[model samples]
Target: MKTIQLFFLILIIVSCSSNKKISVNTSKQSLKNQQLIIDTDINTENIIVEEISANTEIRLKKDSITTVNSYITAPVFDSILKPKHDSFNKLLSMFVSKEGFVHYKDLKKRQLDLQKYIFYLGENLPTQNWTKSDILAFWINTYNALTIDLILRHYPVKSIKDIKNPWQQRHWKLGDKWYNLDEIEHQILRKMDEPRLHFAIVCASISCPKLLNEAYTAENLEQQLTNATQDFLSDSTKNSISKDKVELSKIFNWFNADFTKNGSLIDFLNLYSPIEISKTASKSFKDYNWDLNE
Candidate 1:
């Protein structure tokens, strides 16, 4: 019986030792697994932060480029010209006849008002900061105002050419300098490279584009120009068109290069012409009337 008791005690001791070893190994493996999970979570958090930062930087760079582009391409203008243009508009509505004729005699009676309008234009000539449309509208109004002033100064003149060096003479003052009609038309307006301008300017002659009844305001310049082009083209006396041929104003012949710069003259005309002139259609210039539009 004593021998049996010693063997049983030995077996219990061995069993307790094996259980302790298994418990220690399990605790070590659980700690390692927890550390590995924590390491993976930290790496994922860092990747998310990096991706967000990269996307933000790309957005900021795109915004900066858009701002620079806007500054470069956007047009700027003077606000002061609008009210002065309003005054000119009043005078134009009052004195300009329905057929686009200027009553020089009537305008001469209100010379102070006319001179005041012209003086405003001369003093406030457009600066380089002004938009291309603004500059074009200003010069168109200026050219017409100066023409009327010329006619009023020499009332009853048969033709603009009757006046000595009418276009060449630089008697008019504008923006602290003297300029002639030719300078305004050729040196400034034509150089702007807008072919539609040919239909907006007038020479106070029957053959020239009809002087607009209202002043050309910067706000409505594009629409006004489009209207002028359509009106001029629609005038059968100025431009006669048929299935086989198109007879255009002498103005087109004079400024063929301007109209043909972007495309063929026929293509340009087809934009506004009611009659669809074929590509191979014949073209001719109408006889220009030199008499006063009045």
Candidate 2:
């Protein structure tokens, strides 16, 4: 009985030793796995932060580029248009009345003269010596002249849209290239970053800004633009305003980005608006009139 009892005690001691070794090994492995998981999580977090920072830097760089480019004047051009200017002014005075109403009927009578004027414009495109203002003025005059020509060609129509795809049809030639109305406005004018152009370029509609009686001259470009803005905003029929709310022309909504480049639309409006509007004032768009401006 003593020998059997000693053997069983030895067996129990060996079994307890084995169990303690297993417990220690399991604890060490669990700690190693937890540490590895923590390391992986930290790496993932660092990668995300780096990506976000890189993206932000890219955005800032692009914005800086845009800001710099906006200040740069358009390339100098070597074109002259003294004769074309006279022609443009003559056409403007003949067709565009003092009240800004176009006499399409009377203009149709001088269709040959109008065609000659347009032809003159295509031939005498501005050159590299022209200033930004000069180039801008030339294009605006060309666009207006072309618009009037298009209207006369399709006379007896109610609206500019009466001709299908009026803006998309490449019917006018400028220099060596053919262009559509949309091209002149979006590709050329809007690219210049002149938001007041929205008021200067009339669309031959009642809701559009009135066609100025005089041609847009480079010498008077700044004053003309300022006058256009003030005139358009002051006309309550186009932009009605109050202390708490303001209803602006659809032009403001269509080209909101252009007007709001330096500030909000309200900020732009306040510059020319007669009624003062608060920053947080309620805003809405007026229904655009597409009927002929005649």
Model 1 off-target regions past 4 Å?
1-78, 81-83
| Candidate lDDT (C-alpha), each | 0.80, 0.80
> Over 4 Å off in model 2, which ranges?
1-84
TM-score of each: 0.72, 0.71
Which tens-of-lDDT digit does each residue in 234-259 have in candidate 2? Answer: 89989898878998899988889999
Evaluated against the true structure, the overall lDDT of model 1 is: 0.80
Which clashing pairs does model 2 show?
76-128, 77-127, 77-128, 77-129, 77-130, 78-127, 78-128, 78-129, 79-127
Which residue pairs collide, candidate 1? Answer: none
Count the clashes in each prediction.
Answer: 0, 9
**What TM-score number comes out for model 2?**
0.71
